[model samples]
Structures are given as structure tokens and as C-alpha cells.
Target: MTNDKKRWLILILLAFISALLLAITSTAISIYLYGNKTYTAKAEAAIVLGAAVWGEEPSPVFRERINHAINLYQNQQINKIIFTGGVGEPNEAAEAIIGKNYALARQVKLNDILTETESRTTYQNLKNARSVADNSKLNKFLIVSDPLHMKRAVLMARNLDMDAYPSPTPTTRYSSLRSQIEFLIRETFFYFVYLVFQI
Candidate 1:
């Protein structure tokens, strides 16, 4: 190849290698962070980040999150529960509202169920949850979600200045190594993007 073409090829090769290395490194770091179980004592509320709702019911993944929050409430670790999720469909109930109804049916009182039905994404969930918590003086929060999701969720919580504890569900559908790895990779990419561009 010509000298100019040879140099261009070398640079492109190096760039590709660098990108690959970064992806591997970030994925490893994300897996580590995803398993981290951060918590605090005497929290005022347990914030259940919203997930998909099947029809008018919380989806299995979302139910797992709500169950954890309910466990916290039962143990008195948190005084109240704040459910965050907006409606995904035009006529379906908001995720938070659906979760609240579920909790109430499970014997959690309506008075202690706080709903933030204006957020549909994780970032929005925490932002809207923080607003609801602040209005009710439930400042400290135990954030509940799938284990692999806590890393980014906690990062966003910190950015929003919310006193959030990363309390991931004890078990989730992403239990297999393959599923876990997939989630880790996706989270790493998004986390990196969020860090670099604040998107």
C-alpha cells in the first residue's frame, strides 16, 4: 500500500482495537457495579422504580421490585412506599397506580402507598419519585429494581441529589449467566453514554 494509505489503515486498526478494549473494560466494571448492594438505615420510604405492566397488573419484573419494597415496609425499614411509573398504554393504568393497588390488596394500607404516575423511564422515575418524596418529607429512599439495573439507577439518583440507596431485588428473571451478561452489556453502554453526554 502507499505510505498515506498504510498510515490510515494503521490508525483505523488502532481505533477499532481501542473501542473493543473500552467495551470489555466497561462491561466488566458494569458487572461489578451491578452486583453492588448499597443500603442505608432508618430510611423514610422505599422507592420502587417502575417496570412494564401487563394490562392493569405489574409485570413479573415490576412485581418483584414492588415485593421487595413491600418487604422493606413490613420490616419497618421504610415508613412508606413510593411507586414510580407512568401508563404505557392509552387506557391502561399507570404503573405506579397498578403497583399501589397490588400492594393494597396484599394488605399494605392505602395511606402508606405513595404513587408517582408521571414517569415512564428510569431517570424520570427517580426524578418524579424525588419530587413526591420531598413533598411528603420522605427524603431518604431505598430504591428497588432488578439487580443489574441498580448501577445506573443509583448514578442518576446521585446526580439528582436524592438520598437513594441501591436496594436491588434479591431475585429477578435475569438469573442465568447469559441473561445477566446481556443486561450488563446494555447497561454498560447506556451508563457510558449517560456519563459522557448526559443523555
Candidate 2:
């Protein structure tokens, strides 16, 4: 290869290595940040971020999060459960309704649960939940979601000045790998933008 071509190849290889290293580092940080059990101490509430619902029923992903939250409630790790999510597409049930009904079916008392049916994204979920928490006089909370999704949720909660800990629900092995990779990339880009513009 020509010297210029060889140099370009080396630069490309370095860039690829750097990207790979960054991905690995981010994944490790996510696991570390999200894998801990944060509900060991009693909290005022546990918030289960919403996933998609199918025809007014909780999807498997949403069920997993609700199950985790229910476990926490049953164990007295949290005093209340907050289900957050709104209907985004027609024909799909609101996530909060699906979550509330699922817990109710499991015999969780209706009075013990609060629903925020206005948030359509993780950021909004935290935003709406924070409002409820503030009004309820809850200063600490455990935020529950899929392990891979918890990092962003935790960061968003902290950015909103909420004292939040991550309590990730069980996810199918490899189910989140692709989406996690995409999220990591997108988050990195956005992080840089936020740093630059403080947005």
C-alpha cells in the first residue's frame, strides 16, 4: 500500500478501536450503575417506567417491571408504587393503565398505587413522577426498569434533582443488546451536545 493509504488505514483502525473501547466502557458503567439493589432501605415509593402495552394488557417487558415493583411493595421495600407512561399510538392502551391493572390483578391494593398517564418517554416519566413524589412528600425513590435502560433513567432522575436509585427488572438475555448499543451511541452523542450547549 502507498504510504498515504497505509496511514489512512491505520487511522481508521485506531478509530474503530477507540469506538469499541468506548462501547465496552459504557456497558460496564451501565451494568455497575444499574445492577445494584437499591431498595434495601425503605423508600417512600418505587417508580416503574412504562413499556409498550398490547391491547390494554402489559407486554412482557412491562410485566417484568411491574413484577419487580410488586415484589418491592410486597417486601415493604417501598411504601407505594408509581406507574408512569402515556398512550402514544392509537389502539394501544396507556402504559399506566396496563401497569395498574396488572398489579391490581395480582391483588396489590388500588390505594397503594399511583398512576401517571401523561409521560411518553423516560425523561417525561421521571418528570411526571417527580411531581407526584414532591406532592406526596417523598424525597427518595427507587426507579425500576430494564437493567439496560436504567442508566439513562437514573441519570435523568438525578438531573431533575430527584434522589433516585436504580432497581432494574430482569430482562431476557440478549433481548436488549442491540437496542442497548443504539442507546449507548445516541446517548454519547447527546451527552456531548448537552455538555456543549447545556441543554
TM-score of each: 0.89, 0.77
Compared with the true structure, what per-residue lDDT tens digits does model 1 show for residues 7-68? Answer: 99999999999998988796768656666775747688988989889997888888988988
Q: Model 1, residue 177: displacement in angstroms? A: 2.3
- Residue 131 error for model 1, in Å? 0.9
Point out where model 2 deviates above 4 Å: 1-33, 36-39, 171-199
**Highest lDDT among the candidates is held by which one?**
1
Top candidate by TM-score: 1
Candidate 1 — which residues are off by over 4 angstroms? 1-12
Query: Any idea what lDDT model 1 has?
Result: 0.86
lDDT of 2 by residue, 25-84 (tens): 775575545655454788889999988888878888788889989999999899899999
Total backbone collisions for each predicted model: 0, 0
Worst 10 residues of 1 by lDDT: 31-40
